[model samples]
Target: MKRMSLASLAVAGGILAAQAAAETAAADDIFACYKTAPAAEPDWTAIARDYGHKRLKQGCGQQWPVAATPHPQRASAAAAALAVKTTPRPAPVSDFIWFVRKDFADVDMFGKPQSNEKATGAELSWARNNTAADTIWQVNGLVGLAYSYLNEDYSRFIGASLASYVKVDKEAHSAAASDDSRDAITVGGSAEVGFINPIGGADYVRGSWLETRDGILNRTTGQAKLEWMPMYLRVNRQIPGTFVTTNFRPDLKVQYDERQGGVVPIGFSGFGRSLRIGPEATFLFRVADFGTTLPAWAEPLAGLSGAVTYHWWREVYSGQSGSWLDSTIKYDINPNVALAFSYQKGRNEETAKRTDLYKLSLNFKTCAAFAGFSGGRCTADKD
Candidate 1:
């Protein structure tokens, strides 16, 4: 028993001496917890790897708590976990992009029972936007043909047009307390030029360049409009947990019209160009995200507008003023597909005469690549 006690004493002295020497050498540099449990050590390299900093080494050769290259081999379970997580988070990127949307419309009219007054058309809209911001530019083109029998005469009408719109968004801040509501003010302008052969009365009054006779007689028209949204607000719908949103905006528009036609009955008959200006007050209500709250969520929207137009010409039809009304509805089937319908009634160049037009349209393959739109691929690019 005495011999065993002396042996234990010598072992204890050797351990104590070794520990004291090691501590004296590593007193200021090493972690005390790691000295006791080196196998379960934690540091910045390990932490950074947890969030996907793969190329970083385990020890950057700095002082304690050093941020450096990640050496996954030193970690027990960390290395195994990282080996399984091969995919890396995408870096944020932002830039300008181009988009195309396909659309079809069946257009007809009220107060005209003839099938010639009804037609279906397809249109394509191309768009370009600054994905880093809320501004966009879009151009639309459409072509359609119509044939109908009237007075034993078969007349065919064909038309084509190109229209462009540009929007500059000055306010892009969301006002929702939940950090997702969208509130914006957009200022924009639109211009369209069109040509048609052997048109009807409705097409003629709508400022299309077309003659009423049978063969391919040509008529041309050009128009421009300004769009402004002074204020807008959006909120959760009546339900608390749904992704549906209700929004309201006050919209303003000013339009100018020029049509190539014959001379007026009274004064200034020197030219074939006619001019008119109209200012409108409009409002919009929109609800979106019925299925998912993803970006570019399909939305259903509606709008109404009223305006007083002033038309100027030489004699009989000069200094004419009248009221105009327009309404529209849109329903998106998915992020990439949708349908739209609109009705409009406006004053004519003839005294107190009015013309009404109806249109139904289908839209597909829609893409608006920006952070603000659904289905958009935008990454934050920091310089």
Candidate 2:
């Protein structure tokens, strides 16, 4: 993507021009006043005319002079006013919500004969400006129930999450990689706070308590994460002819957890931990004069980062354990609504103890009305 510095420079130059125009207008007014006198003052009229002539000469920077009028030349004055009006005004920005639905499939290793099952889930979150008033905000959340058809019985599970971000500076901007370039990369980093539930266990915890006597039983609790991931930071920096426009980044993550509830035996204690390192890839498209020309089935989308994740947790209870591997894809359904799909594979021992799992899902969204704001209007489908 083209850097935003070009646009920023344009705005800055306009501001400078407006300042200069205001100064010139003030000088013009002073010269006009000193040269003009009230018409009713008959005695002063002659003197006023001569004085006006002198001031006009000085003001116009010329030798021969003509009496200056009380008002400056209408044309010049109007031009100055117009310059101010044409100057660019700052655009207003706001926080928003990003939501998604998920599904996954996988195999169970603990079962005598591995069985397969399907699961579904949803995520919802809200973002807001974090600067003094409102300049930055982000969100991540999910709440979905998954069921499995195994052993002629039904098994279910739910997952949820939340995340947020804050703008650390008055003037901060982001850029993306160009599609025409290769072997060139950009680097940027951001800090985020996130949490997750349904700690990947089915029957390890008898109820919801962890008991040491029962040999490391399973338990459910809150998990918190502070992560720094790869982002689209640079673009268009190459030696000569080459297809290289890459955004590269490494991440550091810290986590903490507290456990309670579920079928886990008593005496279980939760622990927090941290992780670091590794680079990831992100989505980058050569920007077009009119955005992009995507596949008929694909809508232009916004991407924040690229990181692969693997999660696993097990409880000592019967049929209460799970593990997951997820690959994420996000695309814009249009300008206001975006869709995210995560390919997931995992194992769950919800009922029959050790069963394969699989899931697939699509998310949908629409604009809504809020205080003092005109909600986005519905238009023809862009996707």
Candidate 3:
């Protein structure tokens, strides 16, 4: 398992500056959710040690709600049963492994314009069963990595990557959402991890500490696009030929950069902070062989997924900035391809009265390779 801290290049006055030196660090964050081994196939030893503990905590945590506070009618029934029962019964073990997969995709490299180039990465995972008779009791993890060199200019940044979950079987099939949904309620837990840059410069941070570090230092460059960590929880149900999945993600993030330690005689100082929250929902049609294809949720479209986020921030250098709205829409062109569109707008509160943003992208795997494209000019990669 590896961890990486990634950051974007600095952009000011719509200009890109070259860095003298920069390095991309490797990541070592391994997650075991449903099986053992955690690689491509079941590795029994790894399962017994790593993944088993994670699920026990999750399952046991779920029971607390039902045990601590009982419903009116349910409490009455429990009291009567207590009188007849002597010793408590052991917990029941289900008959399935919680298989999960982790997929990472980007519309553009470092917010650069998407060319007709191609890039891709893959990861495999498996879990080790704890109980010979219980098919679901165990833990494991998996990972996939790929890169593309077809693009001109910064072809080195072009690539695809993935990671999968092994203890909780549901994760293996979680296509409706990307981040971990269960971690929101847990004490200290994590979900699938992904890294985008191994060939970037030093002007950006190197490893997995981006969200927290950037939140505090405000050292992020304008070229940075995906650095935050998000958790997701989905309630999915299957009835006959139809399946429904609901996504809930409540994230608490802190971004800061007082740019303290310096005293400027005039002009506004560069300091800022922000917090954001987003939620999502979707419905899938269970098809034959392929299991499920084309799901619909949020917005109005067949096989679509969308979410709305609210961003709040403040700045001492200037004044107190306000908040704004961000929206997104995505569709699965197929198992290996996807298309997305996004928009954002709001007020600066301290300086500018309004801010606007828009984006569109497509990702697909064909001809034994993965490729993507985006509309609108990108600021992260140009000189």
Candidate 4:
């Protein structure tokens, strides 16, 4: 009985060992299949069918333990990224501007004026974006027309000008409140052609005129000018308990003007170069929010502002020297209309003589009051 029991036990143990070996071999086959699989989505069902492996077919039916399924959020985000890459952006708008200004002098319209200096005038200008390469600088082009009714000599002047300007540098700002805004350096050149007609067609009236003025015989005149602004500073301060704002801008301008004649020294007979260096400063105070807390009667003063400007220039020409001092005070009723009073004591550019004048005028502009007239953005200066 003991011998028979031992034989049965040996047979049972052998069968168990065989089953273990078979399971290990199936696991090895599954691992080998995974190693040869493609990187992209692999068809495991087709791979198992081709290999004719029963273990691989059973493994394919179950979830993969080594490979993870992509998250839905990640897949959606990738799709959005692709869409953005394929989209197109809009283009920028072009600028085309037109501006007009008219100045009416305070004169007795019913009677003849005491002097021709007090006259009405109009100026028209057109500016467009320049296509010059602006990799480092900004460029602009402008054309202007001006008409003056009468000057001191009872003459009318009609002029046309073409100018080009370049902004070589950008404004820089400091962190401190005192040194806030610094304007860019600008350089410009202009060419002007003018026609001067004398009301009294006499040789004596023309003989007393300056060299720069055109006589009746020589009705056509030309001038070329170059301007440079190296320094411009602006400061703004707010009033304590009101909606008032104060602004100050101090600037310097250096300019050279060349007329039709050639260069001639002061003591010498002929013509010479003309140049002027000037410094101008402006101070302005305005109620920024007039309509907010004020009554209806004060609505007209909402955009009201006042400015005072002082100009001092030294002229150097033909070895001769002269200086000019001028001051002007302007009050704006609104954006478009203004009243100005000016006291000028200087060597007059038109008459080329020393003169003192007090003038009052009304100024009108189209760009600020009717923006749509320009068909584009309204800027203080063309750019």
Candidate 5:
């Protein structure tokens, strides 16, 4: 963590830039006209233009070190030297941002799928890359509230998380998940190593692990994943650089109850353990760009993603195998709002924990992203 400097505090208070400009003005008041060359060939118009200098005195007042090049252009030697001393740049837009989102799904919200689930989420985040020390880092804090009712199976969960990501080196997307706070109240973190390429889109195998416990569940769980994008595969003739990403994820879900350890279909017991391993493959292609327009209730399908994962499960309650073929179509409704449709087919214990469900859900998002990653169309960078 970097300590807060006085200049930073002034900047936060919206006074640093004004103060610097005042200082520069004071310095320019002392410019020497005697050392300046006449207003002949070496006019020094570029320096005066950029520095808001309309008169020769402003250019002469430039607080730059005089160069020893005893040549014809002595008029702008000081200006030339001072140009290297650039004024502090304005902070990037929304180094810290706050956003709110609401989602409605026909099926369960990752819980049970028969009933509709209504959820709302909010987040405050900050990301800085190529910092004063030329470093990459991101921090985010978010909370989500969800509710669903299925024949007295009324469920309500508030999941809050805080995490920080930092780049360890200058490799492509080499940032690591340095700190993690999982599911409201987990006093732990995760470590990950990854590498990515602009053209290949992260083709290296990277591993990561995290363990978390919260008061809502009163239990602990550990999750790990190793992801790799082998290469691109042409799904159709026109699609370019279609990526094929593969990964394996392992999960350990355990709870404790006084009664005999046996798993039920719907929920977890006090002292029960379930272990699952999942292998997944996904194909994705970017079909469109930003500012895409769509009709009423229709979204511009910007990117296409389809994934299949098979889960092998072993538990005290039931030992079985389940799988899901999920497909998601991303759409850019506008710069502020985006819509998506996702379908999943799985009865894995690690997921819905119900019988197989033919589920489809639509997500609406209104957001602005200031930093690096390009997750959706509602981005501030416009790149």
Candidate 6:
């Protein structure tokens, strides 16, 4: 009986040791599954497959591990970091704008031209403006210097302009030549009041008073003259799909020429006292739009552009009239350089002379702003 009891006790002890060893192996397998789990969210199915289902269920209390509650400060910081990584910074803008242009032309016409045989002109313009938000109350002051050489004669001009408008849409145009034939330095100024796009379209209406030291029509030494435009209208239009634009300007002009000594017709006759009514029209055609429709060999012609301008005026009282027609074709080699050919035919009202000329030229333009800002080349009316 004693021997039988000892053997049973040993068997009982062995069964207890086997049970202890199985529990220890199960615990180790659960720990290994947890170490290999995904960081974002644990995959219970994968854990159950790698480790035994019975052990996984026992280790996790028959369910997946509960997600940890996020702390408020930690969550907020994480959101901010994500926003910083995803957001884009704004671009820099400039406060002031400036422009400069230079033109060197060979104006020797096919027929011996009467004016502007060989001409070179340059202009520098600068302006200061308030912010674009304060449109109506903000006034812009513009100053310009110009020099021109024509037919062995040279002229210099310096002018300041003050313009107040409802809204500023585009830059004002400037010419590099004086009105009259005189080798002198002239100083002048102009004041303008206008509104841009008063209705809806790209149109403007302005009244201007321009005074010059030596008038273009009559060169009176050291005498100041005035020209007033009571009504000036500019109309602009664009054609769809064709890349064409048109601008038409019509105005009523009255001038006090020292040569005429009174408010006289300024277009053809400088002596008659009359108001002049005129219209100037310009049409621009951009040929580059056609390149896609043409063969690849004809791609070089895509950089060409053409412009046509017509100006006509009539004296109300004296019935004197004059007209000018100009056509130009330009080829742009690059942004800063261009080659152009132009033909001009005009009847001079003051000198009663007729002019017909052909011009071929090279043009260069550049710009600089107050800040370290860069933009396209400056553009101006070419003569």
Q: Best-fitting candidate, measured by TM-score?
A: 6
**Residue 21 in model 3: lDDT:** 12
Cα miss at 106, model 4 (Å)?
19
Model 2: how far is 196 from its true place, Å? 28
lDDT tens readout by residue for model 2, 268-324: 122221121222222222211223454443333222111133545443333233443
- Estimate, for each residue in 116-216, the C-alpha lDDT of model 3 and write its tens digit: 11121121222233443212111111122223222112112222222122111121223333222111000111222223232222111111111111221
Task: Report the Cα lDDT for residue 296, model 1.
Answer: 47
lDDT of 4 by residue, 1-383 (tens): 01112223234334333333333332322223444443444343343232221112223332332323222322222222222223353333322333332211111110111011111112111222235311122111112221112222212322233323222212222223322122222233333333332221111010011123223122222333332221123466778976667766565545454444333332111244456566656565665553357667655655555445454566665444554444445556555555656555655333233446454655444432122333323332110
Consecutive 10-residue window with the lowest summed lDDT within model 6: 105-114
lDDT of 6: 0.34
lDDT, candidate 5, 1-383, per-residue tens: 02333333333434333333334434542234433443333333333332232112334555343323323232233333233244333332112212233211111111111110111111122224443322222121222221211111101111112222211101112244422212322222222222333233222233333333332234444444333423232232333432322222222222211212123222322134434444444343343333445443333233333323333333344554445454444444343333344444554222222333232233333333324423232232211
Q: Give the TM-score ranking, best first.
A: 6, 4, 5, 2, 1, 3
RMSD each, Å: 25.3, 23.5, 26.8, 29.7, 20.3, 27.5
- How much does candidate 4 score in TM-score? 0.39
Of the pair 1 and 3, which is ahead by TM-score? 1
For candidate 5, the 10 contiguous residues with the lowest summed lDDT are 108-117
Model 6 residue 104 CA deviation (Å) reads: 17
Candidate 2 lDDT score relative to the true structure: 0.26
Off by over 4 Å in 6: 1-96, 100-199, 207-218, 221-267, 270-274, 289-295, 347-353, 370-383
Candidate 5 Cα deviation (angstroms), residue 80: 30
Of the two candidates 2 and 6, the one with more favorable lDDT, higher being better, is 6
For candidate 1, report its TM-score.
Answer: 0.30
TM, every model:
0.30, 0.31, 0.29, 0.39, 0.32, 0.41
Lowest-sum lDDT 10-residue window in model 1: 109-118
* Tens-digit per-residue lDDT, 287-325, candidate 1: 434444535433223111111222222222355545555
Report lDDT (CA) for all predictions: 0.29, 0.26, 0.27, 0.34, 0.30, 0.34
